[model samples]
Target: MDKIVSFCKRRGFVYQSSEIYGGIRSSYDYGPLGVELKKNIKDEWWRRLVHMRDDVVGVDSAIIQHPRVWEASGHTATFNDMLVESRTSGRRYRADHLIEEATEIDAEGLSAEEMTKVIREDERIKDPVDGGRDFTEARPFNLMFETYTGPVKGPENLAFLRPETAQGIFTNFKNVLDTSRVKVPFGIAQQGKSFRNEITPGNFIFRTREFEQMEMEFFVEPGTDEEWHETWIQERWDWYTGLGMDPENLRVYEHPPEKLSHYSKRTVDIEYDFPFAGWSELEGVANRTDYDLSRHAEFSGQKLEYIDQGTGNRFVPYVIEPAAGADRVALAFIVDAYREEELEGESDDSRVVLKLHPRIAPVKAAVFPLTKKEPVSTKARELYNDLRGDYSIFYDETGAIGRRYRRQDEIGTPFCVTVDFDTLEDDQVTIRDRDTMQQERVPISEVRERLQRLISTGSAAAER
Candidate 1:
């Protein structure tokens, strides 16, 4: 984990928020490379789930939702974490998490009373920060940010920043159904930010107060809910593995009734291996049988139902939801794609590589000039401009050619195009492969086509 964090900071991937003023706790700002990588991951997911499929349609929902929406969805009442503050240090901790950490088990389903009992009985609830004082008894802490709507301070118009994107999809279900003419067995996908006033938002960006989610609610017939749930689980698994994640680092765990959500009949979590934590959920697919729709229907006194033309039946549609945290997905990609290799020591030259798939690499390829002189840099700059319109290309001429190659390798640019004096005699330049360290001379005009082909097939064509 330390190695990964160091590499991230050194390579300009991410940084702590407000670093200049002593830093903010558990918040992060993505750097240039980090932003590109994250955008690519999100675009790929949107392409696979929305553009490539005919059944799935996407919607963008607001981040701040009506407070009554939370009341209808039960989040205002049930969305809480058990908390314990230290007696001596005054530091706060998630009580269930501390107990779970001590026992190496999950304490998610425990009640406040149950958590308080365990904290009192167990001596291991010491301050992780100070290390000598016992923590206070467990109590429920609401994790919602409450605010007033108007200039007056009153309880009538209080609002909350949405805790999850799933509720927005549910509240707007009838609106989408009416506008789009979508029937049963259709899906509404959304990507938006959610907030939580969490006591412990650690593990880097793995858990944060403000995060984004890519969630989809697949509405289907009631009896076919289980089948759809399994189908989406498989679909999500394939989506990750298809993008070059190691098969061994991913798994699907089925949830028992006790572990399932209050509204879900069945649940499955897609877990990924992280360096700091052994395994954790990357996404979840759940079977929520008419819970959200009925809640909204009862609250708003509106009918959120689908009418069947064949059977003359009218009832609410069952929902199979696949919810994935965007930041978690990006972190998983970084962890799985990271690589360090020892070169053959051709001339005592050392090198390290990121081994990111070309599709997700921050820089597709970098253009290099053999020297900082006029024509070489000019030619390289021209090539950079050409490819920059189609892909993200880096142009560097300040360092040695080998040093520039190492820089590109560290950032996982798959190829490096070098322009030298030979390009004056023949319009051909030497292309260096980052992974293999193999160089081949090719026509300068063919660089764009060659890279496009290589990125498409994950391999270069024969020396063309």
Candidate 2:
């Protein structure tokens, strides 16, 4: 865990948000390389979920919605985490998480009192600060961050930063139905920032007060809700593994019947093996049996039902929701793709690489010159510019080619193109594969088409 965090900071992937002022708690800023990686993951998700699927379309919702939207969605009344603080350390924590840390025991189904009782009863659990015995009582803390709307600050004008993106889709259900050509079995996909006042936000980017989410709510007929829910779970699992995630490290955890959310008839989480937290959720698939749309209809005085054209029957559509945290997915991709290999003859430094998928790598390829001198550098610049129009590329001529390759490898650039003196004689240059460390000579004119073909085939044949 420490190694991954340090690598992220040193490689310009992520940094503390307010580092100059000694930093902020659990707040982080994605650096240049980090931003590119995030964008690629998001683009791939949108490409598969929205662009490729005819039954699904995309929506970018506002960060702040009418306060009533939350009320109708039941977030205002029940969105909370059990918070407990230590008297000696003055540090607060989510009771369930703290309990999990203390006893390798999952406290998900336990109530606040139960969590407090378990912590107090267990002799192994002690105050983290100075190992003191004193602790504070557990209480429910609402996770919503509230603010005033318009020009005034009062209860009448209260608003909240959206805690989830699903509500926005629910509120716009009628708007989309009235305007679009989509039908009952269609889906509304969204990707946006969501906020929660987390009691304890730690573990790098795992749990934070602010984060991005990629969610899709598939509305289906009541009888078909369970089947659609199962289908989405498999589809989402395949999405992650298809993008180079290790299938062994990903699993579906079924939610206990008693622990399911109020809106969920059945829920299952797609969990990944995280470095610090072992197995944790990467996404959740839930069967919300008309709870959201039905609630909104009653609260907003608008009918939120879908009409079947063939049967002429009007009914509320049950929802199958697959909600994933963008931050978790990005972090998982980095951690899962990271590798360190020993150099057979070198004792000084080991080779570190991020074996990311070709389609989702931050920089698809890097262009370099074998020497910084003329013709080599000039040709490298020309090739870099030519490929820039097609793929995100890196061009370097500063240091040793080996060092440059390491730099690009650490950032998950799959292929490196080097323009050498040989290229000046024949229109051919050396293209090196990151994974296999094999080199192939190809005509300069075919570089673009070759790269396109390699990406389409996932990775170059030589990379194997």
Kindly list the per-residue Cα lDDT of model 1 for residues 44-122, writing each as its tens digit: 7889898988788888887777887998998988888899888878889998888888776578888878887887777
lDDT of each: 0.85, 0.89
Using Cα atoms with residue i matched to residue i, what is each candidate's TM-score against the true structure? Answer: 0.94, 0.96
Candidate 2, residue 180: how far the Cα is off, in Å: 0.8
> Model 2 Cα displacement at 165 (Å)?
0.9
Minimal lDDT window, size 10, model 1 = 455-464
What's the residue-level lDDT of 65 in candidate 1? 75
Segments of candidate 2 deviating more than 4 angstroms: 104-106, 345-349, 462-464
Please estimate how well model 2 matches the true structure, expressed as its whole-model Cα lDDT.
0.89
> Which predicted model would earn the best lDDT?
2
